[model samples]
Structure formats: C-alpha cells, structure tokens
Target: MKHKIALITGSTSGIGLGIAEAFAAKGYNIIFNGLEENGSEIARKVAGQHQVDFLFSGANMLQPEALREMVAQGTEKFGSIDVLINNAGIQHVAAIEDFPEEKWNAIIGINLTAAFHLTKAVWPNMKAQKFGRIINIASAHGLFASEFKSAYVAAKHGIVGFTKTAALEGAPYNITANAICPGYVKTPLVEKQIADQAKAHNLPENEVVKKVILAKQAVKDFVPVSTIAELALFLASENATTLTGAALPVDGGWSAQ
Candidate 1:
C-alpha cells in the first residue's frame, strides 16, 4: 500500500515543524511549504529518520497562485494529499488605527486566505478518495479577543468559521475539517511578542512573559508545540472521524475564562 501524505504549510519551524515531525514519525510522507529556505535540512533529516518521502516548497503563502501550485506539486509527487495542515501565519500588534494597512493585508492573506486556497485546491482529490483530514492551526484569539491584535484575531476567527463550513461541506465525503486553538506556543512568533510586550509595558522580558503575556492563562505556561502536534495527529487519525467542525482548544484554560 502507498504511504499517506501530509501537506503542511509554514512547516519549516515552530508549531508547523512540530506537526511535521509527528506525522513523519507515524510513517507519513510529508510536503512542507514555507517561505523559509532553511527547511531543506529538516526535510532531509525527517525523511532519513522515518524512511519516508519528503518534499519542500518555498511557496509564498501570500500569493494564491503559489499556494495552488504547491498543492499541485505535492499531489503530483505523492499521488494524494491525505492530510492538510494549514499552519502558515504571521502577526502584527498595534491599535486598529495605528495598524498599517499592509500589515493587516499580509496577516489576513497568510493566516486566513491561504488556508482557504489550500483547502479548495485539495478538496477534489480528498473528496474522490473519500478520506481526508484538514487541520487548521488557529489560536486562542480565535475564541476571544485581545488588545493590539485586531488583524490576528480577525483572521483566526475567520478561519474558525471557514473550518466549520468546510466541515459541513466535507462531511458527506468522509473528509473532516477542524481547528486547533492553542493559547500561546513558545514559537519564534511568541518570542517576538515577549520582546514587544516587554518594551510596550516597560517591564523586563521575564516579567512580561509571566505577568503580561500569560496573565490571562490560568496555567501561566506556554502550550508546548509537541502537544499541539499530538492533537494534530489525533485529528488526522480514524479515531477522530466524528470530531469534525470542532474548535478544540489546547489552551491552558485561557479560553475558558
């Protein structure tokens, strides 16, 4: 039998990379898409360790055409994209009035629109095969709101809605769509937020992380990327067939509040 394939966007590092590693360990072939060029080594390493095929696409998620091409290349190489993980995203923190128009566009385009495009691109193949898993990496902001995060929050919320729509449409075809809302993973993105929050609040970085950045989280801890990866694997498994259209929160009680 042919090995299953997973196409994960923005999978060069952080949460995306974590998911890729988890899937590879499960013996799934992987197609990694991201703007970064440094993923070649990771691709080689994962493939070597798992003895599975790995491919990388330096596709800019901002462009819909590039995203379409990425999906096409993955399908062509692997014969099918059984799992789709939409994890590409960016962040910009500013009041709505101060938020640059370009920044809003970039965030919305990469974080929300790119997922739509990839899902659209892969829907037919998945529908035909009668088996597919669409896992979106949203955030805690998808469920709630925060200051200085209009665009990120909006984009994440939009993805949640989109995931539901996809789930409904895909239910008959045995394709599932779901979003993972994590509180705060200690990714480079959050690292930048630590610095920004420290500067903005005139607090030390350590204090900003504990007192400001994670102030709302009851656990006061960053959700591990591996934990999110485990969730992704579960969602992709047959055990989660009935769990579509869910916005499962891996947040440390952040969304509960």
Candidate 2:
C-alpha cells in the first residue's frame, strides 16, 4: 500500500484512529475524515510520523451532500482513493417505549446510511481504478441483538447485509468489501457506554463493566484497539483481495456463542 491512498471516516479518535494509525504504519497515504477540526491536525501529525501524504476533510456524515463533498475534496487532494474504511458511527440505547425518534434517525443516518452514501460516491472511482478495499466497522451487536439498543443493532445488521452485497458487486471489479464485528472495545465511545450502564444500573463503574459488558464474552475482557486496527490493516492489504464479503468477528469469542 506504499503509495496508495486510503480514506477512513470518523478518524479523529477511537477505532477509526486505530485503523488510521495501522494504515499509516504500513506506508499508505491516508485521507482522514471527522466533523471536528482536530481530525485534520491529527492527520497531519500521523502523516508526518509515517512520512506519507495525508488529507483531511471535516463533514457531518449524516448529510448526504456533506458525505459526497468529503469524498470529492479528499480525492482532489490525493488523486485517487485505493481503500475506504467506513468507520463513522454512533450508538443510542433506549427502551422501545422511551426511545426518541430523533435519536433513531440520527443513529441510523450516521451509522448505516452514511456508509451507503460514501460507498456509492467512491464506487465509480474504485471501479475506474480497478482496485479498492472497503471495510466497515460493525459490532458484535450486528450479529446478536441486545435489549435497549434497538437502533444500533438494526443499523449494524443492515451494514452486514450491505457489506455482503457490496462485496459481490465489487468482486467483478477486483474491489473487496468486508465488515469487522467487534465486542466491547475500550475506546472512549465504549467508555461512555460503560458510564451510562453504571448510572442506569445504580452500580459502580467496575461492576457495571464487568457484569454487563465483559460478562457475555467468552474471554470476558475488553478488546484492544490494536486488534481491530490489525484486522482493518489485513483487509486493506493485497493479500486480502480474496477475502471479501466476510463479517469477521473479532469479539473475543462473544459472537461464537
């Protein structure tokens, strides 16, 4: 991937940042996206660290036009995109009776529909170049349902189906599409979920984390960011061209059960 350009969405922090760092470590020029200004700064730093060209774009993925513009701007700067990681997503949990309609819309718009739009926008470019790697950061929730996380589960499941269909379509073009489904990863996003669980269960953070998040996993431990990052790196590499349409689970045996 040494002169190839990869675009990873929502890369300011968390799993997206991990994937970006992994790609940078492999000498791939990266186009980083986030709604925050800090994303660009981080891209500059990572590019410098890796000694590769880096591009940044700030766009709210919820808007279709913004998503298109983000891809356009990145391509204008980087020439062509060789890989795309659709890693931008949000999570909201609430009982069916109390779930906010707006929250549902926001979660689906960002987590599911945004990937669709971005992939559509990049499809022609990948086809034209006759090469692409598309990886979506789904979750264990995608394969298993959890109470009070209706929208998140639905969106992720949708992503898995979307990934398989995309993989089939891109196969003829030599483009590979896959999804990475992970369990509890200790990112700030999952940290927020732990905090919310603690408050809702009226338990200490540790107990809430142990009994709620890690208890379901066979290994019963939080997955490291490096695990997911390495998975993304493998999917982005030339060796993985044959490994498309897979919803690979990196959930410490959570989904295996």
Tens-digit lDDT string for candidate 1 (196-251): 77766788987888888889898978999999999999999999999999999988
Give me the runs in candidate 1 sitting further than 4 Å from their true place.
Answer: none
| Top candidate (TM-score) | 1
- Candidate 2 lDDT at 120 equals 96
Q: In terms of lDDT, which candidate is strongest? A: 1
Per-residue alpha-carbon lDDT of candidate 2 for residues 61-171, written as tens digits (9 for 90 to 100): 888998899889878888888888999888766687888999999989999999999999999999998999889999998899988789999999999999999999999
Q: How much is the lDDT of residue 34 in candidate 1?
A: 69
What's the TM-score of each model vs. the native?
0.97, 0.96
Flag regions of model 2 displaced more than 4 Å. Answer: none
